[model samples]
Target chain A: MLMEKSAVENGFIIDLSSIKNTSQLVFELSSIMEHPDVKGKNICLKLGSLDLKQSQLLSIKALIESMNAKIAFIDTKSEQTEASAVSLGIMIKEISSDLTADIAPSEEDFKDSEYKEEAVEERTENPVQDTNSQEIVEVHTEVHNNPIETTEGIEDIYDEVSAQELSEVIPSENYQPDGFGILAASEGLLPEETSKYILLDTGNVLPEGVEENSVNTESMQTLYINQTLRSGQTISYDGNVFIIGDAHPGSEIIAGGDITVWGILGGIAHAGCNGNITSKVRALKLNAIQLRIAGLYARRNDTLNVPYVQKTNEFTPEEALIEDGKIVIYKKLRRD
Target chain B: MTGRVIVITSGKGGVGKTTTSANIGTALAKSGYKVVLIDTDLGLRNLDLLLGLENRIVYTIVDVIEERCKLRQALVKDKKNPNLQLLAAAQTRDKTAVNAEQLKEICDTLKEENDFVLVDCPAGIEQGFQNAVAGASEAIVVTTPEMSAIRDADRIIGLLATKEEITSVKLLLNRVRPNLIKSNEMMSVDDVVGILEIPLVGIIPEDAGIITSTNKGEPIVNDENALAGKAYRNVAERILGEEVPFLDLDEPKGFMAKIKNAIAKLKVKV
Candidate 1:
């Protein structure tokens, strides 16, 4: 409803002003660019008042080019997103609010929506794309979530605990006994999320001379395997990786696109290893020791090391992605 | 064939690390595997003593690393078992005498000819521990049920995780007193495993025979009647990828022991 499209004689505009996060914006734009007619056409983007890092903006540019298309320019309301576009060398043409009503297309090559691109957002406002093919991949964000590292096994063995426990907080059974003493500590319970993982301070883990880019994850080839990844075994692939079994602790999985696991994912998983900002990692039971997305790396909280997890049938499917320059995991996967 | 290099390490001193190394090495050799036990404790070497091969050692590991003798010359063949050998540590030199790279080179060479290279690490996580671990791709962390030992094992486990080459880090609980655990005086196997969060390799019961074996320069695993020996043998089998049930420490077999246990229980009740 926030979009309008009036297809002028030339290239079109994509207005993504309503999207809340960079990942959603890129995900939606990539789906639209998958249209057959959209290939080879220069596109204009109307990115709303969302803050974007230089890496994020560059990834959006890469996503468009990956579809055989290009972004001619972009208009943004937020100074942060605008600054990112400028630093990335993307041209920014401001489409003023006053000029929206004054500019009308007398001849409609494509028409739909309330109002769309600036000539472009004005086009998306008139979205004639229903007659054409416009399938935008929707990323529905579910707000409520249980504890972070929630495992479902207490019912199988204990029998008394029926429900999936809210993020279980494990205290570090570690302490410095003396000047050089350990093997004992006072176990104190603490709030999760803040205690579970400390973001590794290694600055800009992306390789030197490498820029962040989002290759349409759906376009990349997916490697499928059914095996429990053991310690010391590493699976590194250039495309999406789909594991049908558990990734045990000490094992590592690195992929260029998304990482999806069918069972418990307890090892280190690096999704979008090539720095694609829109890539995600989802698992049936996601209690990974370390979660890495694009350029961000987070270690499992040392206090959360008590892995009393048993492999049972019940699963609390979880997903992890990058948001606000940090790795945020959502509990339930929502579809619309 | 490339042999597997396994390091047996315990952070706290006197946690049966040397005893576990000697027994497991002997047991592996008994299973017909060509095993070489590397005493990496350096200044405080004891694997040779436990194997009763200290007197037979003509050249130590330092001699080989320093290029004074060949690796073959330094490997002391066991008096009884030709399949088992010991690369005795230099008692005269300190831990600083050997670097990690030199130890890794020695391990690489020995592993080329042997089936299993078990490195007996020093007590602490110092130069000796690093030198021992540099050669190993697998690790067996030995710990007792004592709070101090379990704590130190946790620290050692964390340290082992940092090494990229060392893949499998398993736990071996030593000197587990079943009677004490029954009386709630000591931590049980479950408690230790829950705290450590690693797969158990084996659990050796506290046997007075280990003391005699250590004094006589013999591994307890060589004693057929010793429960500790059977436990060590089972550990070797498990390492070979055979699934073996853990020994129930409470179950004492045979008529004589059964009668003695019954009488002791009756006396306690009276």
Candidate 2:
């Protein structure tokens, strides 16, 4: 039941002397540490041959903390004397006892001979020493061959039981690849992929609803707009926009759902940008630059049409639809 | 017959909004039209004082809305003009005492009883201004020849264009001095209209009588003998669909004795 874990831990010896965009490089490195599979493993980033900026070092430390891993950066460019001074601290703590035992031999040999004699006498009287000696030999052989093999055997048992439990807990459609994440887009930017749904999905060629170039209002998602959008600003969402106030002209608004304006809407709005065909844009006042839905576009002010010299005052708030493969404007039926 | 309401406003303050409202109301009433002037300035109620009807205000617009009095009881009859009335704003309360819907309700009731309901709006484009424009079908932008006033007038016109579909929006240029315009020291009426890009309603020349009338709590329109007052009456007649000759601001004034004396008085006041 355990899937093949693609654990690829590669080391990079990045020459800081050759890299110019250090900040961008550090950001990419942080993304590497945040990779879903190897994120929890211990990572050692060895820094070399350069003076890293304060911001760059701080960001590296922050990335290490986020992954909950250990990092050891080897600075290889320091003076030899200074390098040896750091090594001196490591030698005193780790090598002092080993060096003394290797050098002071006769006194240590006399103590070791008595200890061996006591161990031999105890082994002769107790059968537990025989079993303990055999177990120690097996443990030493496993350590030399592959220490992680035992951990893998235990992991296989837990993986099968957990997979069975998880299958019952979650719906099949909710499952996605581990690396899947949400992409955030800014104003005027389009998403890489768009989704669309029909108003009436009959089993026939012709859609039950003949409405075209309109938002698929049955699946409208409401988006709350809290700011006064100025002229020349464009806002698009995969959901309807609820503007608290006016939307100025020279601005473009596109939504995959319905668009509502509590105040005036003097800007262009394209509902059902993903071709939902039933979404509608509503506002207190609608004097926009253009209107579009699905494959329909209301290109009224274009100069290609000769002598349709309509002033801005002549335009009124009217709904748009596609009729006979041509976009047209219609007067909204008055509620009164 | 419900009267069509119109609110006179400018985004910038002190560009003669109240003066235009008082004069236009007076001119409308002088032509035998039933005109009701509603001061929507709240605590800073100045229309009553300008119209010379402050002492006759027994109840304010707030008093009627609060059920302390009837709408009829709150209307202050103009002292000299029988056709003119004033709905004075409450001096004790701020603008929050009423909102756009409440003001709209009041104007709806008043429209049934009057020929024209002129709402004197506050200066800034805020709640007070919104209350003034509520239930109104038309707008009158008042501005001077100065750059700041013209800019604010453009912004107010832009806001009105966004809010509702208005049929007629005209600009009334006030406090214009013809001599300064002739000398090229001030913006001409055409200049103000060209920048704001709106239709010109009327042009009011600089007359010392306007200041004197404000000081005495009298509308300049009361003086039918005055030139600026006649200009206001012309604007009112135009509003009523009557074609009238515009004032010949470019024409040389006659060397008559009366104009000479008036010019001397204007200079002395200055």
lDDT of candidates 1 onward, in order: 0.70, 0.59
Give the per-residue lDDT of model 1 (tens digit) for B1-270: 789999999899999889999999999898899999999987677787677654345457888888876788778788678999999887656899999999999899889888999999999898989999999999999999999999999999999999999999999999888989999999999999999999999999988767656755668787777788889999999999999999988974332231122110000000
DockQ of every model listed? 0.01, 0.00
Please write out the lDDT profile of model 2 over residues B1-270, one tens digit for every residue: 878788899889998889999999988988888999999998777897687654345468888888877798788788678789999987657799999988999999998989999999999999998899887888999999999999999988988987673556889998888889989999988888889988778888777667656755678787756678878988998899888877976653322222222110000000
Residue-level lDDT of model 2, residues A1-336, one tens digit each, is 000121112212222233345555553354344333233333323333444432234334444444543232223342442233132110001112333233232433334466367445645755553453333233323332331322333333223223212121121232323321111111122111110111111111122454434534655667788877775476889877778877764356777777777665655567677766666666655444445555444432211111112233322244444444433333332322
Find the 10 residues in a row with the least total lDDT in model 1 chain A: A135-144
lDDT of candidate 2 vs native?
0.59
Which model scores highest in lDDT?
Answer: 1
- How good is the docking of model 1, as DockQ? 0.01
TM-score of chain B of 2: 0.91
Summed over model 2, clashes come to 8
Instruction: Give the per-residue lDDT digits (tens) of candidate 1, residues A205-240.
Output: 676666788788999999998898975468899999
Which parts of model 1 are misplaced by more than 4 Å?
A1-336, B253-270
Give the residue spans of candidate 2 off by over 4 A: A1-336, B250-270
